[model samples]
Each structure stands twice: as C-alpha cells, then as structure tokens.
Target: MKALRHVLRATTVREAIDRVPEAFYERFAFAFLLAWLAAPLLLWWVGPVIGTDITFLAWVNLQVGLGALILVALRLAAHLVPPRDVSWRVVLRDELPLVLLGMFLLLAVLATALSPTAEALDGDWYRRESIWTFAAYVGFFFLASRVVSGVLRRALLAGVIALALITCIVTLVAAISAGWHTDEGAVAHRAIAYFHQFNHYGYLLAVACVLAAAAALTVARRVLRGGLIAVFGILLLTLLLNDTLGAYLAVVAGLAGLVTWLAVLRRLHVTTLLLLAAVAVVVHVLADALGVGVAAEIASLGGDMVAVSEGSADAASAGTGRWGLWMITLEQIAVSPWSGHGIEGIASLLPGGYGRPHDEYLQYAVFFGIPALIAYVSAVVVVLVRVVRRGRAVDGITVCATAAAFAYLISALFGNTMYYTAPLLFLLLGIAWAGVRAAGSELLDAESTPLAEDRTAPTPII
Candidate 1:
C-alpha cells in the first residue's frame, strides 16, 4: 500500500518530469549542443569546399536543419507524453520576450505565404534563411531556455570560449604565413578564417571579446581570471587583424555597454577601471602596428562622406556600397508596408546582383514585413533591458550574454543577417533568458542592492 501510494504521488506532470534524473536532461542538452557546434568544423574539414555552390549549399542545409528537427521532435514528444498544467497568466507575464519571438515567427510565415517569388518562399541558393530556418531557430531558443542551466550552462559557455580562441589563433597563424594582402590590392586583407565571409569572422571575434572581457572582470579565481584576460587580449588582437570596421565598432559598443551596466549596478571598481584602460591602450598600440590604425579608417570614412556630399557619381561605390542599397531598400519597404516579399525576396529588386540589403533591420523588414521586424527587435530589447535591470551582479552568464547581444546588434547595422552568425546571437540571447529565469528570487533587481553592500555573495564562474 505504501509503494502504491508512492507511485501515485506523481500527480502533476511537473512531478513526473522531476522523477527523471537531472543528469539525463543535462546529457541530452550537451549532446545536442556539441553536435550543433561541431557541424561547421566538420564541414570545413571534409565537406564541400567553397565555390562548389550546389554541394556546399546541400551540406549546409542538412547540417543546419538536422539538429533542429531532432530537437523539435524531442520537445513534441515531451509535451505529448506528460502534459504539464501550464499557468498561461504566469507565462504571459514572465515570458513576454519569448511570446514576442513567437509572434515574429508567425508574421514571418504570413510573409512567406504571401511571397511574390518562389525564391523568397524557399530562400535563395546561397543564403537559405527560409521560413523553416526561422522556425527552427525559434524552437531551439525555447528549448535552450528549458534545458541549459547550472553546470551544463557553464560548460556550454566554456566550449564557446574555446571555439573562439581556436578560430582566432588559426586565423592569426594563417595571416602571418600567407601574406596579409588580397588579390584586389587592399592594404591588409580581411580575415575570413574558416568561414566564407570576412564579416562573419568579424562577428564571431566581436562577440567573443565581450564575453571574455566580462568573464575576466567578474571571475573570482585568480588563475582563471588571468587566463580570461589573456584570452581577451588574443581576441582583441585578432579582431584588429580582421579589420572589419563594423566589427571594430561593435566591440567598442559592446564594451561600453558592459561598463555602463556595471556602473549602473555600482559594481565598477578601481581595478576594473584600470584593467579596461590598459586594454584600450593595448588596442591602440596593436592597431597601429597592424597598419590598420583608427586614424586611417576614420580618414577613409570621412573621404566617403565628402564624396557623397559632393554628389560624386561614384560615391555610391565607396565604403561597402551600402548607401545606394539602403536607399533602394527603404523605397521598397514603403511599397510593401504590410505584406513583405519574403526571405531573399528583394534580390530581384536590388541592383548590381546583390542578394542582401547589407543591413539586418532593413533585411528583416524587407523579408518579413515591418511587423515582424518590430516583434524581433522588441524581443531583443526586452531581454536586454531585463538582464541589465534585474540580473544579479555576480551572474557572469547574464553579464556576458547581454554584452555579446549588444555587440551583435551594433554590428548588424552594417552587416546583413548571416546564416552562421544569426544562430549564435539567438543562442546567446537564449542563455541570457535562462540566466534571468534562474535568479531564484523576486528580489533580483541589481539596483536594489548594490554590489558594495553584497560583497560576499557567490559569483558563478561562467
């Protein structure tokens, strides 16, 4: 009778879920994440080489969609087998950003259904950011929020840091050995590394630098903190070598965001300030040595502005050729204010055979309409605001994740949504979401109790 009662004690679905070992969920999350992270490296090693368009796209399509499909299937099975009593009110109040993401996905589907071209519905051959991809992204995000926690979460972050370090080190070695100039005779060739696009490489470095900087600042272990500082130095140096202006600006913006948040929480100390100042000095010195100093880049930008102001015919050709493309995209957005053309829909409309708008906000509006864009931006803003306002000062995950997201947003202004980089940004955002949820207290506001008053609190080394 006692055994029967024990078995029957699992009345709620939440209780049934709790019956399973916690290790099971952690292992499942780790396996899924490992496979996803390894996909790119595996492709680079044995899969299709660049310029073999069809085979490369086929491989990428399979790699990107496979893990996501498995995750979706697992999530569905979990829901079907043990239905939990969900409080819709609580979800609505607490998970507003996630709800907004869902709305964005739905709006994207609507846009895809009403797409004018077949390419828009299925995505173009090169950049296959179809509706399916967006759906998978959203699913992965929601699942990440559930499974990624505690030790597994820290492991995932460490893996990401290691990946970034490996990539930057390899790129630096290549640049040193293989002449740093490209065929077009540019001063210093941009570092594309294993990825096809230099800007994509820039995106990775920019985010990694912010994460490393945050970890170095907050981690309590002396050796670990020193290692993180070294990692930050390498990342910053590689970022300078990558030499993408948008990425440079992104790193600056991200660091600024991190410092500002720390200051707001009253966590900024003299040591941290001195460390940051030293980092800045090192960056300037390295930039000068690399022959891609700040002054040179600024002069180039000024020259472009001057040409544009003087109405030069070739002004549109200067500085990434983005001015003309942005103008054209704005005009098209006005035409289709409600129903968008769908993913990669504006390719035909764009001049010079360009496939993307070179701007993420414009890309979102063009592909999925204005409402979708608003929903996506709103979700990001809400998550960012929540992390800055409510996350505890000792929570390194929240600090690093928020900083990385900020960097990505700033970089996205000049770079289009990339298939490789977009997933990373979403993952960081998801981790941030999870960190916010795991605060375990209603008194979670960082501003309510400053770090100075709570010096003995434990800090997670993530």
Candidate 2:
C-alpha cells in the first residue's frame, strides 16, 4: 500500500506544471489557435507552388512546430504575468467533451485490439487513424480553453473566421483554375484545395460558411462584418461548385438553427431574411458571370437529393454510392450487433468501391458498436442542449456558436465529418465554452470586487 501510494502520487506532474507560470495558459491558447490557422494556408499555397499535397503533413507540422513554440511561450508567460492555480473541477467542467472523447477513444482502441483485422492492413488503419486524429484535436483545444480566462475566447473565434476566409480564398483560386464539371465526379471533388477529397473540402466550406454568416450577423464593426459576409459568399460559391448535396443540407440546417434562435429573440425579421435573399441573388449573378455554372449546380443538387430520397441508382449514386452502401452496411451490422470490429474494420467488410459508411452515426455503430454511437451522439446533443439552454440573455457570439454546431450536426448525418469539418466544429465547441466561461467571470467580478461608497448599487449586467 505504501509503495502503491508513492507510485500513484500526482506530485511530479503538479510540480512540473507549478514550475510554469499560470498566466501562460491564455497565451498558449492563442498560439495554438494561430498554429491551426496557419496549417491550411501552408498546404494550399505552399503545397501547390511546391508541387506537393502535404495537407495532412501540414497538420502534423503545426502540432510539432507550434506545440514547441507554445511551451516556450508558457515559460515566458509564467514569468511575465502573475501566476494562479486552476482547480480540477474547472477542468472537468469546461472540458467534459474531451473527457467523453477520451472515453470513446479508449473504447475504440480496446475494440481494435480485441477484434484483430482478418484482411490485409491496406486500409485497416483509416478508421482508427481518424479516431486518433479526432481525439488529438479535442484534447489539444480542450487544454487550450482550460488555462485561458474567458478573455481570450473571442480571439479564438476570430481565429476561426480567419481560417474560413483563407480557405474560401484558396478554394476560389483552385475552383477557377480547375473549373467545375457538370459530369460525374470522384468521392471528393477533383478541384478542392488543401483537402484530400472533394466531400472533405465541401464539408469544410459548408461549416466555414456557417461561421462566416454567424460572425457577419453579430459583429458590430461594419468592416469586419462586410469582410465576413464577403467570405461567406466566396465559400457559398465554392460549395456550389463542389456539388456535395450533404454539405448543402448541412449548411442550410445550421442557418436554420441560427435563424430560429434569432427569431426567438425577436432579432430575426423580414429585413434579415430579405437581406439574405439579396446576398444569395448577388452571389448567383456573380457566379453566373464567372462561368462557374451555378444554375447547373442547383439543378444537380436537387436531382441528387431526389435520388437519395427515392433510392435511385443513377449518375449521382455512381459518384457517392451512399444510399446503397448504407443499405448493405446496416445488414452487415445486424450480424454482429455489438462489439463491432475495430478501426478500419468496416472497410474490408464492405463491398468494393464504397468508400466508407458515409454516415458518422452508422460508422460509429458499425466500427465501435452501438454504445460508442450513443456516446458520440450524446456528446453532440449535450453541446446543442447546453447552448440552447444558455438562454437568449447570454450573448450573440454564444448563439452563433450554437448555430454553427447545429449546422455541423446536420452535416454529420451524411458524412464521416468526425474526420473532416468536425475538428473545426470541435474548436468552435471550445470557443463556446470560452464564451460561457467569460460571462461567468464577469458575474464573479461583479460579486467579488467591492463597490465604491459613492456607487452604492453596482452596475447592472446587461
């Protein structure tokens, strides 16, 4: 017992953290945010110019390069600013998503270990690799949010908007050069920049569009709002060119959530909807002039949606193959209802030419078993519920975050977004935490600080 007590002690870890200044957490958070923002640009600009597609490698480089920089910044922050301690309760509360994510990852890893792959290891790693990557972002961003005060949350959101703007710029350049095709396409569009597959790019843009729109709606500064709105237009055009129906549906769902929230608050009215319509019309005219074929895309998206609903095996199905693949996948899952084969377990079992489950909920159920799927959905549901329950009194940013999350959830129904736009959405989740936590801080400041005698009553918290 004595030896066990010594071995289990947390003194060493705490001592290491203690050596670092507490004030560094906020800076570390910002530095990490900046690193992520730099990654897509590194891939899109540097990759094409250098004749390489190192999108995944760029992600890895940011983790290594920026991670070290953050460590140095942490040391500097500790010394330069006053140090304070954070309680474990705070971490547990603010980082519950990550905690739940860790649990899911652990289950996935264990499942993979227990259910060894019978087939060759060619693509057996895809599912497992995605889960690992997802876990990394959740853990990294959760920690980033943990140390910083609510003060840095807005900066983090702005960082997201910056990423969206850059992505839109890269996407527009790539689409213009590559040109859009009305014919059948590959799994991911062929012309996407900074992402491997077309759907991946589509999903990213769709989520970014939501982010940009949210920012445009709430931002007080006209210049920033205009910039965001412009970015949203660019992103919308790119999404149209990609021709991903799932992404389109997801983006609309997110927008609806935002609109509903605004309407509930009496903020959404005819002028707002009319302005949105005008923006869409202006973008459509611009797209038509640019020769991107916006009208064809609208027709194609409608046709694809109809096919999916009717389960028609047509030209669209030849491209995505989602409806049919899902049918076979559900049958496969029925045999082994629980304790699904781990990781890329589904790929080998699936019929040839079908990429993945294509649905995240189905992927979770077939890959990690039903329990993991429940947990996965629960985590997302918790965020949506939390944001909704935060009430109209919270703030515009928080409401925006909720809208973005809802849009992503709607998209997740169609793709393994956990592998793509999900990381971005997870970052938004962290920002949401920051927004809520910041509000709480203001409340704390009001209660803790002593009021001057002249000001008998404290200022109302608007």
Candidate 3:
C-alpha cells in the first residue's frame, strides 16, 4: 500500500527514529538537557496555552517514559558507528566507577527482588525517579563523552548560558505573577512559582545563580558580563526571598567550593574577593530591610552545626517533624541495614506522625542498601577528582561545575534533592570528565614535544 511505502521510506515516526544519525545522540542529549532545565515550567505553561491541566510530576513521569524510548533509539543509532574495542585492563584503569556502578545497580535490582512488597518497586515515587534518572545520566554521559568535538564542546557551554537565561526569564515572569512577595508563612510564593515544591525551587535558584555568576566572570565583554551579573543578582534575590535554609546553605557551599578551588590553584584575585564581599554586604543590607534574617541565621548555623555534631541532633534535622522521621528511618535501617528492605518499603513500617526521611543518603540506604550508597559516593568522588586534577585556571566552568556538584551534595543531606538536580548535575560532570581528559592529554602532548611560542594563536575555547 502507499501508506506502507511511505512508512518503509522512513517517513513515519518509527522509521525516522531508526534512521536517526549517530551524531544526533549528542545533539539530542544537549537539547534534552536544555528542556530538562525548564521542563516543569514548560509543562505548566502548556496548560494555560492549551486549556489542559497537567501536573508537574505527571509530566515528569511522561518524560521518564519518553526517556526510555530515547534510550532505545540511541542504541539503534549507535549501530551506525563501529564500536571501539576496549580491553578489561583499559576499562579497569579508566572506568572503575562505571564498573562499580553496574555492580551497584545489580545489587539494587536484587534487593528490590528480595523485597516482599513487589508493588513498591514501581509505586514508590522516589525509587522510580532515582532509577530512571540514573539510567539516563549514564547513557547521556557515555554518549556525550564519545563526541567531544570542539563544536559540540562549545555548544554545551553556550547551551548552559542559554538555559540559564531562559530560567531567569521564566523566573521573572513567575516572580511578577507572585506580585513580588515572599509570603513567608504561606506555601505559595515567587520562589515556589512553577516548581510548587519550595525547597527544590530554592536550590535550583542557587544553582542557576552560581552558574550565571561563574559564566559572567568568564566573558570578555563587559556589557554582556554585566547583564549576566544582574541576572545572577536576581537569582540571589529570589533565593533570599525563598528563605529556605537548606537552599541558602547549598548556594553558600557551592560558592565556597568555587572560591576554594580557585584559591588552591592560586587563580583567586583580591578584586574578586572584594566584589564578593560587597555583594554579601548588599544582600545583608537588603535582607535586613526586608526583615529576612538570612545572613544572621547563616551565622547562627555555625553554632547549630557544632551542637548537632556533638550528639545534639535537634538542630541536625531541619525540624522536629524531620527529626521524628529520621528516628523512624534509623529503626528501619537497624531492621535491615545491609540490603535495604526496598523502595517504599518504609511507608507502612513507619510510625504514626512520621514520614520518609528528608535526608538523601538515607533514601539511598533505605531503598538500595548500604553498598549502593557507597557506590554512589565513590562515583561522585571519582568524577570530582577527575575533573579537578591539575585543573585549568581560566575555565570558570570547572569551578562552577564543582561548586554546583558540592551544592547538590550538601543540599541532599537535608532533603532528597537528586531527582530535581540529577540531569543538570550529571551533564556538567560529563562535560567536566571530557574536558579534564582533554586537558590532561594536551598537557602530556606539550610535555612530550617542544612547544614553540606563537603569539598569533587563534582564540582557544574555554
């Protein structure tokens, strides 16, 4: 039939998917990375535009299903390029974390199988998000790493800037919609905006702010840099308005990481420090005027943290509710500490007035067990070391990326943040992995050969 002919000609969706170019994987990865940045907001916008009511997490679940389809298409498209032969020795030396990751996943699956409530495997919301996200992260990381051409690498950075800009625009619209108020006691506020979830929006704002700030520092032109700085300032303002202590701590941790990395490399400058100090002063003055004691509260956290570390856990848990939940999680851990009882396994086991622990480490342990938790930490440490080793001084991406990673890491201590930040976090780490490897290779090449000075060098890609 004519219809079958058109389908056979790769005109249909199925055929088109099969015919996707190998290079499209990296491009698609970047595109999806951009979409993921504003997906919730996009979904929310579509409701008004199309006269439909689609909730945020529902949209996310649909995205997860589509992600599975993408994985299949990527696999089929991969057949276009000949596979490289990698020896066990080479893999062990270069990708031990990846190997460990496979083992960890295997353990997790086995743990889930061992769980009595099989329905929890899919019914558990956090479990579903974590697994799908991890799979997508692994697939995208490997795909992106394969095609690190100068153009692709450049696109990634530009894409990040573009994504940040889009975030700022959407955030402004959301803020304006909120009538520019924090509504401190109320749940709905400017910072919550499309994200609805306050803490996720808060930390996301922190990440965006640092990302904008770092990118601003890297630009050569003053006008564009100033604009980015303004955007970063707006993001800070949103964070201040949100007043989520965890998000505040996360952003501060990230900024601290950025400063520490630069300082250790001797790339930190006094002017930069003074500018940062000035920003802090401005933020404090504004917060004081607004009656938001964020700066003072942050100072108080120093003592609070000390108190918690010294066996007083009231301050350690964000609140009494969280403290009660954490106690229940500890009981669950004691019941099955080695291999976890499984995802959503704690729901029924939990006591009255208690809920899931806000802590992410506990989430991993509760669902996938202790070994999987260890594997996750090991993987993070490996990537951080790889990206940061003998680092590049001029590229603010590494510093920003590292800071972002640390922020997510610290933020997760207070809540299950990985679901919200996973894609962006892993994307940066993937780029960092490729960049670090390239930088290391260039260094080796330079050491092996005599490099002649050339003043008329084409401008390098940061």
Q: Which candidate number has the best TM-score?
A: 1
lDDT of 1 by residue, 415-441 (tens): 887666776777778767766653345
TM of each candidate vs. truth: 0.83, 0.76, 0.77
C-alpha positional error of residue 260 in candidate 1 after TM-score superposition, expressed in Å: 0.9
Model 3 accuracy (lDDT, Cα): 0.58
- Which residue pairs overlap in candidate 1's backbone? none
List ranges where model 3 is wrong by over 4 Å: 1-22, 48-86, 92-96, 116-121, 124-134, 140-184, 189-191, 269-273, 299-320, 349-354, 393-396, 437-439, 443-462
Q: How close is candidate 2 to the true structure, as a TM-score?
A: 0.76
Specify the poorest-scoring 10-residue window by lDDT in model 1: 453-462
**lDDT computed for candidate 2:** 0.59
lDDT, candidates in the order shown = 0.69, 0.59, 0.58
Model 1 bad stretches (over 4 Å): 1-27, 48-86, 182-191, 303-318, 391-394, 438-462
Q: What is the Cα-based lDDT of residue 367 in candidate 1? A: 85
Top lDDT hit: 1
Ranking by TM-score: 1, 3, 2
Q: Model 1 — TM-score against the truth?
A: 0.83
Tell me which residue pairs clash in candidate 2.
21-78, 188-198, 188-199, 189-198, 254-407
- Preferred candidate (TM-score higher): 1 or 2: 1
